[model samples]
Target: MAILFRRVALVQLAPRLGDVEYNLNLIEHGVQRARAQSAELVVFPELAVTGYFLKDMVSTVALRIDGPEVARLASLSRGLELIVGAVEESEDYRFFNSALYFRDGELTYIHRKVYLPTYGLFDEARYLARGDRIRCFSSALGRTAILICEDLWHPSTAYIAALDGAVALVCPSSSPLRGISEGKDHDDNAAYWELLNAVYAQTFGVFVVYVNRVGFEDGVGFWGGSEIVSPVGNRLAKAKYYEEDFVVADLSLKEPRRQRVQAPLLRDENLDLTIRELQRIQRCRGTLGHQECGESHADCEGETDAGLEER
Candidate 1:
């Protein structure tokens, strides 16, 4: 009873800022539309519930995992699998920008954004707490990992997912369109994002289902361009840029199996070697204790990894 093929929907939506009720309606409609088309799964962009750039209004729209908002979201998963993002309020009252994966009408996995960018026009670290781990979980579509927003910018997140035997990397992001040129049709950041998606797909031999939002929030536009990249670095499906669009891609598990057999990069990844190198690096930086890496910096000065140097 292995699932080899299924149709997946990408909801490149634009949520009304701080309006959770309106966003819920949009999600319900999106689910109905996708389910009618016989899609096995549907994905939304990061912060889909509350919208991005909710500077001070973040808490006002935050939803607990067991709250009615999530219950309503889970209710959408009677037959179809779904992935959505929201501001999660923890029991300790800390909020996190998180992606929730639901299967069989139950909350299965929640991935919080780890690397919060606090630069010009981006201030996630100011309000949200960071996630500590990257894990691969099972679903009807097989093994998958959810990395929210800036988590995709860090290669280690994807690397860990791949190493943990993830067949698909599901990234929900709210990246704004930047570096607009007069003659160009797409933003500079959009092209770079496509490149990143392709690189991750081909390198890890895993399907990359990248769902990004569209429209404006606080005067900053988000170029949708949501795309699904195949294991061998091919664009399987792409949505319209700067507009709301729903696109479905029929994906087969056989492709990732074939890509791994053909390229075998994931097969060649040396986890033990990587761990040793990381321990050594940490020891050199005085972060690791003597038991794991070494007693002092001088003891590990000669130890180096080419991967570390290259990065």
Candidate 2:
């Protein structure tokens, strides 16, 4: 494979909901700023176009994949590859949480968020349709895959993207604030960091760039730990918590190549096969009654044999 561009910048913008004009201008400004720094690619936070708290209004403001808003951004992105978020309308008239990639004065690719988060403050299931596929958008940089906030929390999507020829993973999120009102014991911010590290280091060994939103919205303040993680899972650079700024990092494509050669996690036993086998084993073990399950391996083996015979 050929080596691509080595420098990129992430724009962590603090955007408000239902503000289209302002967000468009802000994205254009961010692209220019990244170009000034000689960065090849510029990534913005998730849902930066309309803000994340628009709730039901997302459908009304959702732009067609070929609409004017993206066209304007594409024209403005002359020298930099820009990845920004907006609501996208599918051909079937369904709306999706989407990201548009603009490069070389045109729209390159669009990724609809695959994982629709329903827990806590998120109700994406109510507004946007979930994408059932994984894909990598071809860019001048390299084979790149895009994931929205919640998808990064799990390894399934990342591994699938890697298998599909993604050498770099870009995750854009509107991460909400936690721990302040819930008190000190609620500081589970490390979960985000830990998940990022593991995804970068263990599964694909590819470059992981995460861009997160900052500032408060509807009583939730986002934790801004926007960062660039290396193939070995080391955090190369990161933004401060609850602030707005840009972080630029120079990554040699040679790094991931070197790391993969040393530890080829991608070529390990097929995960699909492992998952199927595990499911089969679980089926054999059968369900246990409330208080009947214990440390007895004999009972478990007997149940497994019985279930297998019945099958």
Candidate 3:
């Protein structure tokens, strides 16, 4: 069989605050540049259309899934698949941090951010609703999954996507630079992202692509160390930090299969056993009528012990 190859682009651009038209025009220009280089898939940073740090402006600048702006993006993505981040407004006017996938002049899939950080410099939970589902979907570049910013920090999110047969994991982030790591080329935030990307790629035996924006907003600076990691956890391409850049790299579809066969982590995973163990853990919460059950108090205690032992 012939091996399939795809050229993917990671666009790290600074978005104007609350300026949807300007950001959209920038994105269109980036897409045109990527298309000129014959890129099959182009990915952008989180909230690339509306910009991050939009405390109250999120609701105001949120785009409907079927809004005219989306149509314009769909039209721009005529032949190539484009993954860009934007604030999505629901029918009831609720807003969500979302990533939209456009291909063949049509919106293919939408991944709403599941984990919204509200600690420290982040306050996403206050502005956007959380997404409930995480699953892999078919894309032009084979089975793929999208995780917005903080979603990638939770290991279960990537694990679920990997179990669902995702060959590539794409993450769009707008992470800010915080602290300085000694002897490292990037900041602490960038270093942590590199570690996370490598771990996920190696553990799941899947390609990992991360795109982060660069620029200062409200005195906070976003770090732009966007990168592409291979299935074996090798850094294939990386963009410069604290600057806007457009980087592209070609990936082989066979790499995931090759790495999976070498590691076999997915083949050894036990979903049913995991589910049963989780159920046991939940049952150990000790509700009102627990001791009245036929299993007796001793068995209930044993369930908790057994759950711990399984872990």
Candidate 4:
């Protein structure tokens, strides 16, 4: 059985970092336009609410889970399902890179980013704490898991989310693609990411939608090639790079179940065995120096599996 939906709109937003009012207006306008097209679900890039490169102002603009920004989003999403990224501030003053899911005028779930990338233009570790668990949120479409950029690069996170019964995974990213990524003989960085998304989609046998921001923020330019992939690891629809646009595609969640049943990758092995294999490989690299064999594992810094470019 292949379960198919009519349409999902992935909106590529080019937001100037630190501009809250402007970003909000864009969101509202984007929603109206998406509604005009009769899209069932509308998704925005990571940090679409307040912008991505917060620099030192991350704490200033960070909002509580039930703060006014979220409330406004809830109000704006009266007739549609929306996923937008924001900086979340806890009661204890801790902060997180978070994604909020709203459906039919109600705030449904908050997914805090688990892997914080501290290297290469990102200083997330300085601003946010990491999430401890990976699970799926209940949605009208089905059970779906949310992974902010870096989470998709780690196989364990996706595997655990799938084990937790996620039918699909949504990744919101601010991909820092600086140069041209077109033409036949482009750079490997672009190809690497395309492969990364394909791997997760194929391995888990689930639909994956990755939304990325466009335009340059501060000094870092975000590459806006938001894309959707089917369970068979084929790219279904992709938005243009360096352009603010929306791409819609019809997805079938039921087809993943059929593919998994035929492949039987999930039923064939145990997680412990897979972990052991990964550990063996890690030991070969002398990378197990930090000690991750136990429940309370060490920090996941240093060569963290090229977690999907949001870092």
Sort by lDDT, best first: what order? 3, 1, 4, 2
Question: CA lDDT of each candidate?
Answer: 0.89, 0.79, 0.92, 0.80
Error of 3 at 133 (Å): 0.6
Can you write out model 1's per-residue Cα lDDT over 135-157, one digit (the tens) per residue?
A: 88886557999998789999999
Query: Once model 2 is optimally superposed onto the true structure by TM-score, how far is the C-alpha of residue 16 displaced, in angstroms?
Result: 1.3
Candidate that would win on TM-score:
3
Off by over 4 Å in 2: 1-5, 180-187, 275-311
Which lDDT tens digits does candidate 2 get at residues 1-311?
77544788888888877778888888888888888899888899899898897787987888886788878988877876888999888889898888888897888788888898897778899888987777898764478899888887777788778887777889889988654444432236635454765566546878888888887878878777788888877787787777888888887777677778888877774878878866865765554442156444433344545689899
lDDT per residue as tens, model 3, 187-256: 8988889999999999999899999999999889999999999998788889999999999998988899
lDDT of 4 by residue, 197-268 (tens): 888888878778899888887666776778988888778889887689888887765768777987778777
Segments of candidate 4 deviating more than 4 angstroms = 1-3, 178-187, 272-311
Question: TM-score of each candidate?
Answer: 0.91, 0.84, 0.92, 0.85
Query: How many clashes show up per model?
Result: 0, 1, 0, 0
Q: Model 3: runs farther than 4 Å from truth?
A: 285-311
RMSD of each: 4.4, 4.9, 3.9, 7.3
The most accurate candidate by lDDT is 3
